[model samples]
Target: MKNVETNKKIIQKKQVKIYYLSPEYVYYPIYNNNPKFFVKSKSNVFKETLLFEDNNTKNYSNISGQVMGMKNISGKNYLVLKNDFHEKYSAPKSFRRKVNKLTKKEILDILNENDAASYSSDIKYFINNFESIDSLILNLLICEDSDKIYSEVFNKYNSDILEMFDAISQIFEISNPVIMLSDTDDKNIEFVTNLSGMYPDIRIVLSHDKYPASHPLLITRKLNLSNALVLSSMDLYYLYSIVKRNKKVSEKMILISGDALNSDFIVETKLNVLISDIISLCKIKLTEDDVLCKNSAIRAEVVSIDDTIDTTVDAIIIAKKGNNNPKECINCGLCNKNCPQKINPQMYKLNNLPFPGKCINCNMCSYVCPRMIRKDI
Candidate 1:
């Protein structure tokens, strides 16, 4: 126990690369041991940074902020917007007003009406595209009551995970797969394990951690994983499933959250819903005359929802100000001081440190900044 604690302290002292892995396969990998040191490869790292920066709209080499991923497929491209994924958006009033008893059809219709595609298509696509396989390993945080969504299939297979496995086994000749429970709560893990055990041959492993252990690919690689299917949260999966069901299911789940909006409510919305519609759902109280946001402050570009009206669109961000480029160092050494490991932040920016593979990407520097400067890590 002492040795374990000592090792943890040492590992925490430096930067680390954390990733999330999917458990849709039979065998997955785990690092032999926690990674100790990071190799900084500037050319490789910078190239990767540029690849993910959405587009070359901003010059990143000269900037100290982190790069973000933003790619729009709506025929028109825009700058990457920094919005909260976990943060909720406002529920549509009509949808909320009628929330007395939402049937599956009403829910699907509401999402369809708002132009936000449901998860129906994506799920069907997974079922269709992949060769009929007998095994399934879902990441727990991503699973919702799919039995509720796919009533017909759930009804046929009983939607009980074990039943689903049994049905799958009948369809494809393969061994039963194990479900990895990412939750540390002993109760949740045991519940899933018990439920899974109902199947003839199924195994379960419970995991306890806050962030995703690593990207699914890395985890599977470490575990020697070869074949599997992966899934995400309900909303995302819903969208994917809907897309699979119908190609026209192009609606998106626009998540708006953070200190900006005091409320967080996930809503299904259309791919082309106006900014005003989104704000209305978000329950933002800004009047037409009141400045909605600081155009230059947000990572996303600004656009008008209606040319004749003053209201912004669902995709617009109304902040209080713009971001200022860093010119002078505060000399407080906060960036270096707050680093999980004692890495020099100044050196990171100055090109003195060529490789940032060790950086844990905890956003400690961004969190402690006086300027609220955004880093898209």
Candidate 2:
């Protein structure tokens, strides 16, 4: 075979390439007549107490409401009780004393906080009026917690996620469909497997691992499917209805993790959210003195959290120093030795190579560094 100069002709002749261009994002405004659909809301912390003598309440007991609380202050907000529910708390310290308590209402509030119309109303308009199915498009729905599904919106419609999965199964019925599970939790595996098995030619392949092993895209790759639709584990039913009814998605799912003042919780935020806002969501503390990192050490660097509260900020690593000089390669060969994909990173740095073709951007070199030198792309 002659040396292939251009990928275009060769790729076309050999049919070794696949082209599936991402479509232009078109927002389909979902409208529902009856509002009050459930959505995960931004957690709010309110300090309250029954201001009375003998504040010696052994524990803030007998308070009853449908509340979902977390033990770890690292990734979520904790509610603090200063006064009884009867007494109205004051401002300033009252707000600071109690941690944010996340609820569906709070999530909806954040979604429509900027817009004049309420998010509930927005949802209702879409659910009730929209009739076109062609408007549905793909959305990258994400969930942070491994076990739980992130059900924020789309809970009120008849076409829920489970039904959507059934539809997708029907579409892929020609292929031997298998359900792959990412978590070791047997209950989750059982539920998903049983649900997937309802369709005619689909079978279950359960895998309990830490990573997203059950991701349909990854599974499809193994199954060698021509096309695949990836859906989030959270509210598969809701997403299904949204896709089936409106046939479109305006937003994409993003996960916020790492060090911050607040605990980590999934929020349905806009795409343009800034880095600063994301830090506030993490619930992890970051003083001027603190540093943050994310993904891997090589990819980690300093980030500023101000003005912007968005998911993009959470993935950043807050560094202590700025890049003094794009440090010259030390020829330690460590980058080569540590590469999981067997690519020579040190050579790329030394030669100032135009492109390191095999570089997967794993950031392994940055992780093994003693001086914390930022990795070159």
RMSD of each: 19.0, 18.3
Candidate with the greatest TM-score versus the true structure = 2
- Clash count for each candidate, listed in order shown: 47, 54
Candidate 2, 222-267: lDDT as tens digits: 5465434333433343334233332122233433433222333444
All candidates: TM-score = 0.39, 0.41
lDDT of 2 at 224: 60
Whole-model alpha-carbon lDDT for candidate 2? 0.34
Worst 10 residues of 2 by lDDT: 1-10
Candidate number with greatest lDDT: 1
Q: How displaced is residue 236 in candidate 1, in Å?
A: 8.6
